[model samples]
Target: MKYPLLLRFLQYIATLASGVGKRKKLFILIYHRVLDAPDYMRPQEVDIESFDWQMALLSKYFNVLTLEDGLQRLQNDSLPARAVCITFDDGYADNFTNALPILQRYKLNATFFIASGFLDGGRMWNDTIIEAVRNMQDSILDLSELGLGKFDVSDKSSKNQSVREVIQKIKHLPFDQRKNYVEYIASVSQNLPEDLMMTSEQVKKLDQSGMTIGGHTVNHPILSSIDLNMAESEVLENKKHLEQLINKNVKFFAYPNGKPEIDYRENHAQIVKQNGYLGAVSTQWGVASKVSDPWQLPRFIPWDKVPHKFMLRMCRLYCA
Candidate 1:
């Protein structure tokens, strides 16, 4: 869905009305890749050139702040107008080798959300499946042996999009079952890409370079798919891993998949706080406030195809 131009104008007007004359803050942009996306299941993981251009545009107007600073200023009401914060989810290796230098060159800082498990040969199952399908040539991939229904990977021109249909079939399973299905595909497939996910060393490099590390659950599981103990364990294990890696207080979180169905909820927030995290972030889009629950803040995912749409959204907030 498109953000109406008139609606944007109204947001600007509201900012003016709430605190006339000062710049107003607008967004928290969530990204996951800086190099090529293994597959484009979602558009946020655009290539480096597109990311460079997005940064160039954002650097022009906004005072991009680290996630903590943004929240603190948001509480103090000290943010400039057109303010926004940038975040990288899943802690892709490229965020260090590719995206970080860009932010550093622009002298910008952002929160780097790390899925504790994916570091050091831990590939997200979703990413593995996307790559696996992209490499496969056959129209149909049958994995009923692994207990999943058949996957038709061919073109969907005369009918629905083949990839979408395949993805729908994949998504139809229970979360745990679907991950196992991806694992089955990856184990059987060849021509796999580099473990595109980050390593502990890379995360340390970012932390030492002055970036903030946030907890994403270990194994990247859907919290709701499991019982309360398992969900708490997911949160605890992630925080423990990052703290051990960075040796600093890790206080933030990004919900895996960021959907209500994916295990992010009030219970998740309680786990975060009880584990001593200061705040948490969600994949849902919008601006946040001091009054906003830090454990349930909203985030805007930057789309790969449309930089102008990004520009308009950030004009109403901030970006890095």
Candidate 2:
């Protein structure tokens, strides 16, 4: 069966299971870039209009709560009916410019997990790779010499696929190796964009204005791929940096690439707990429940745009 049809059937069953009523589980919605125009180079981005609509829907149908409050409720096993928390990973400038307004319009609060190393005019390695790949002068650049496979960047679709393939190949590599590879690509490609991340001032302002600022590693390195000491440093340094920058305690964390037992592991969760973080979130898909591990909280993004379909997807999550 087609994916959409399957999903629709599942949603229907979920609706029947609960009469499409709100569940007691806590839903943490995650996002990345909220751009006025969708960043073609970063296809994972949500445009401002779509974001506005989503927030409006959440405001109307869900009991959106602050991250701290939601976590406390989860801890006490007293999560409100249909509890929800909004979060943005990899603090982008557009979070301040685009997302902030929509959030404010809905009178909602959100937590932003910042990769400290990207502040003050720095870009994540993935963004660097995307910029480099998108700007390549040659349609079919050969990288077999680097021991990576050759790419066919003959058109927009091909270039996008090439970018994804290269990033997938290097993402789980040790941090230094991935950085070097991305830098090498940037050197060979042309017209790399500058400073895609939020500045220290922007971060400070966001925190001051009531948004929770959280840590997301120093350079967004996958914790399980690096040495334990390095991973600890990444987690600790990011927390300390955000604390000093925002002049407030950085309480929460989100794992880089956040896959359970893949991008991060048990030891990394231990590191986060040892660092005094209240809890850490992962890219794992599920609603938060009383039995859920606070140190490895799972989160997911809702992708449907149609209102009823989106609501049904939320219903599915509630039942899942």
Give stretches of model 2 more than 4 Å off: 1-23
Q: After best superposition, candidate 1 residue 78: deviation in angstroms?
A: 1.9
- In model 2, the clashing pairs are none
The alpha-carbon deviation from the true structure for residue 97 of candidate 1, after best TM-score superposition, in angstroms, is 1.3
TM-score of each: 0.83, 0.92
Q: Report the lDDT tens digits of candidate 2 across residue range 191-277.
A: 677768999999999988889999999989888888999999999889999998977789999999899999999989999999999
| Candidate 1 ranges with C-alpha deviation above 4 Å | 1-26, 36-44, 143-150, 155-175, 304-307, 316-320
lDDT of 1 by residue, 26-108 (tens): 46888888875433454436777777777875675456788888888877888766667899888888899889888887778
Worst 10 residues of 1 by lDDT: 155-164
Candidate 2 TM-score, true structure as reference: 0.92
